[model samples]
Target: MGKREQAREEAAFMRGDVGVDGAATEEKQDAAEVERGKAREALLRGKAYLGREFLTWLLWRSESGEPVAAFEKTGLSVLFLGRVVLKGISGDVTELSARGAMAPYSEQVRQGMDRGLLVHQARLMLTHGEKAYEVTLDAEFLDIRAAKLPALMSEEDDSRTGERLYLAEQLSAMITTLVEAFIAVRAGRTWSKQVVPAMKEWMRGEEGTRKQTALQRAASARKR
Candidate 1:
C-alpha cells in the first residue's frame, strides 16, 4: 500500500473503524466506562445514606448514655451537645428540636423517630487535647456549619491565623475520620443485624429508660 494510504488505514484502526479487533477494543473501553460510572453513582448513594444513618446512630448513642464517642486514632472525642434537630423523612415532614438535659430523652424525639424521622442535624462539642470545637453538622450532606473553634493563643495576626487554620483542619479531619468509620460499619453486616435493632429498641422506648434517667438526674440535682 502507498505510505499515505497505510497511514490513513492505521488512523482508521486507531479510531476503531478499520477492523473487528479494534471495534471490540472500543466496545470494551465503552463498557468499562459505563461500569465506572455505575460504581461512582453507587458510591455517592451509599455515602448519602451512610450520613443519614450515622446521624441516627449518633442520636441513639447519645440517648443511650454513650454520648462521648471517640475517634481513637485521632485522639478526638465527640459529645452530642444539648441541642439536636430531627426532621421527618416522610409524611408531612415534621421538624423538632430539643435542648437542655432533656433533649435526648424528649418525647418529641421519640415520637419523631417512631414516625420515621431521622436526625437531620446535631450540635456537638468535639474535644482534641486541650481544645474544644463546637459545630453543627448537617446529616444529608455532612456539612459543618456554625462552627466555633477554640481560641488561638497567639497574639500576632499571622500567627493567630495560622493557628486557627491548623485547628480547623484538625477538626475537619477528625470529623471525616469518624464519618468514614461509621460508613464502614454501616455498610457491613453488623449494621443491619445489630445496630438497626438497637436503634429500633431505643426508638421504641421499650423500658422507659430515658424518662427514668431524666427523673434520676432531677432527683440528684435536687439533693445537690
Candidate 2:
C-alpha cells in the first residue's frame, strides 16, 4: 500500500482514524482553499502589472514605435512585478495570506488553471515580450520561491517556522531594489530634464559644466 494508505490503516487499527476523519478532512479542505486563494491573489497582481506594461508598449509602439532602449525598461518593470507576485504565492497560502494584501495575488493565480491558462508562462510573456528583454525578470522572480525551498523545513509547521517570516523580509528587500531600478531605467529612457540631468549631476558631478557653458554662449548671442 502507499504510505498514506498504510498510515490510514495504522490509524484505523488504533481507533483514531474514524474519530479524526472529519477534522482531517476539514484541515485538508482548508489548506486547499487557502492555496486557491493565494493563487488567485497573485494572479490578479501579476495581471495588473502585465496589463499596464502591455498597454504602455502598445500605445508607444503605435505612436512612436518601440525604442530600442525602452525594451529594457518595459522588461524590467514586468520582471519586478512578477517577482513580487511569485514571492507572494510561494508557500502555503495560509501562511503567506496571514501576512497581508499580497495574498490576493495568490488567490487570482489559483484561478488561472480554471481559465485554461498556465500561470507561470503567461506571466512571463506579459513581462518579457519578444526580444532579449523578454522575461529575464520573470525567470528571476519565479526563482525566489525555489531559492526559499531549502529554508522551509517539511517537518516544521508554518506557524512555528521561521521560513515564512524570512520570506517576507526577502520579498520586501527585492521590491525596494526593483523600484529603484525602475526609476533609474525610466528616467534614463525618457530623458526628462529633471530626471536625466539630475541623475547625471548626481552620478557624474560637474561634467554638466560643458552643457552649462553652452547655455551661457546662447545667452550671450541673444544679448549681442
Candidate 3:
C-alpha cells in the first residue's frame, strides 16, 4: 500500500474499533471522514506537501511526454514554460528561481534537487488546437496565481462578459481535472512502485546525460 493509504489505515486502527469483519465501526468511519476533511483543509492551507508532489509529478509527466490521465479526450498538451521555482521544504529552507529562455534547462534546477529542493511554482502552457493558455501554478495551494486566456471572440459587451466567464470556468475545470488525475495516480500503488523511482532517477542527473536521455525517451514516446 502507498504511504497515504497506510497512514489512513493506521489512523483508523488506532481508534480501537475494528470489527470481526476487519472493518471500521460506524463511529470510527465517521471520525475517519472528519479527519480526512481536516487533512484536505490543511492541504488547502499549504500545511502539507501533497500540492508540491502534484506539481512535481505534473512537470515530470510533461517532460517525459507521459499523457495526462484525465485530459486525453481534450487533446490538450501541457508544457513547462519559463519561470520555475524550487524550494527546500526542510532544514535551512533554500529557494531557487529561474526564468528566461533557458530556465527549463537550467543547471540550477538539478542543483536545487541535489540539495533537496522541490518544484514550488512553475509556469505552464497548455495548448489545445489554436488556443494556448499560459498560467503560473503554485505548489503551495495548487492555485493559479495568474493566467493568460485566449482572446475573447465576442464583440458586444454583454456577450464579451459571458465569454469571459465561460473561459474562466473552462480554465478552472481544466485545472481541477488535471489535479484530480494526479491525485488518483498518487494514491495508487503504481506511484511508489514505478513513478517515484523514475522521477528520482531523472532528478539525479550526471553531466546532463540523464536529462538528455529522459528527453530523448520522451521524444521517442511521442512518435509512438
Candidate 4:
C-alpha cells in the first residue's frame, strides 16, 4: 500500500472509526470509498501522485526488461506503448504527454522523468501466453479506462462473453500481481537501499544522453 493510503487508514483507526468488535464503521467504509472516489475523480480532476510513483517504477522496470512475476505457466509480460502522460511534482510545465508509436521512448518523456515527473497515464500492452491485452491504465485508480481484450477462441455469443470476462479477470490479476511486486519492494528495506538508488540512476541519464548526442553531431560534422 502507498504511504498516503496507509496514513489515511491509520488515521481512521486512530479516530476509532470502528463499530462493534472493532469492525469497520460507516465512516471507515466511507474512507475506503473515498479512496476509490478519488481515483475516479482523477479522470476529470487532479492527478494521483502516489499512484503515479508506482507507475513510474513500473515504467522503469518494464524498460529494464525485468520480469515482475511468473503468472501461471503462460508467463505475463508488460510493455508500455503509444502514449505516456507525465506530470511534474512541483515546477514549470506541470504536465505533458507524448503520443504516437514511439512516445514511450522519446527524449521528451525521458526529460520529463529527469524533471521528476511521474507517469499520470499510460497505455500498456500485456502479453499473456500467446495473446496480448491492451489497456489504458490510469495511475490513480489503477482503473482500466479502455481495453482491447485478446482474441477469443469461443464461437457462440455467450461463450465469447464468458471469454471476455475471463480475459478481464486475467488482466486484473496481472495488474494486482504487478502492484504487489512493487509494494513488496517499496515496503521492504531494499526500497531506500536499492530501488530508489536504481531509479535515481535511471533518471540521471540525461547527461549521458546529451554527451552521446554531441558525439553524434561531431561525427556527422566530420563526415561533412
Candidate 4: where are CA atoms >4 Å away? 1-47, 206-224
TM-score of model 3 vs. true structure: 0.70
Off by over 4 Å in 2: 1-151, 158-160, 189-224
Residue runs of model 3 more than 4 Å from their true location after superposition: 1-42, 91-93, 206-224
Question: How far off is residue 141 in model 4, in Å?
Answer: 1.1
Q: Rank order by TM-score, top first?
A: 3, 4, 1, 2
* Shift of residue 27 alpha carbon in model 1, Å: 23
Q: Where does candidate 1 stray beyond 4 Å?
A: 1-49, 63-75, 207-224
* Clashes per candidate, residues 3 or more apart or on different chains: 0, 21, 0, 0
Local accuracy of candidate 1 as per-residue lDDT tens digits, 1-224: 89999797789887877585544444345644564454345435655444656777765654433333355444655556668888764688667777875565666787787778777788776666667787898866778887988878999999999999988887788777666556556655577798888778777877543535434543443343
For 1-224, candidate 3 gives per-residue lDDT tens digits of 89999777777778766654668676534644565455456666785377777777777677644445445376556767668888775767578888864465456675676677888888876666566677898887878899988888999999999998887887777787777667667656577799887777666763244335334533443443
Ranking by lDDT: 4, 3, 1, 2
Counting only residues 3 or more apart in sequence or on different chains, how many pairs clash (N, Cα, C under 3 Å) in candidate 1? 0
Q: Model 4 compared with the native: what TM-score? A: 0.69
TM-score of each: 0.66, 0.22, 0.70, 0.69
What is the Cα-based TM-score of model 1?
0.66
Best-performing candidate as measured by TM-score:
3
Output the better candidate (1/2) by TM-score: 1
Which is the winner by TM-score between candidate 1 and candidate 3? 3
Q: lDDT values of the candidates?
A: 0.67, 0.33, 0.69, 0.71
Which ten contiguous residues of candidate 4 have the minimum total lDDT? 209-218
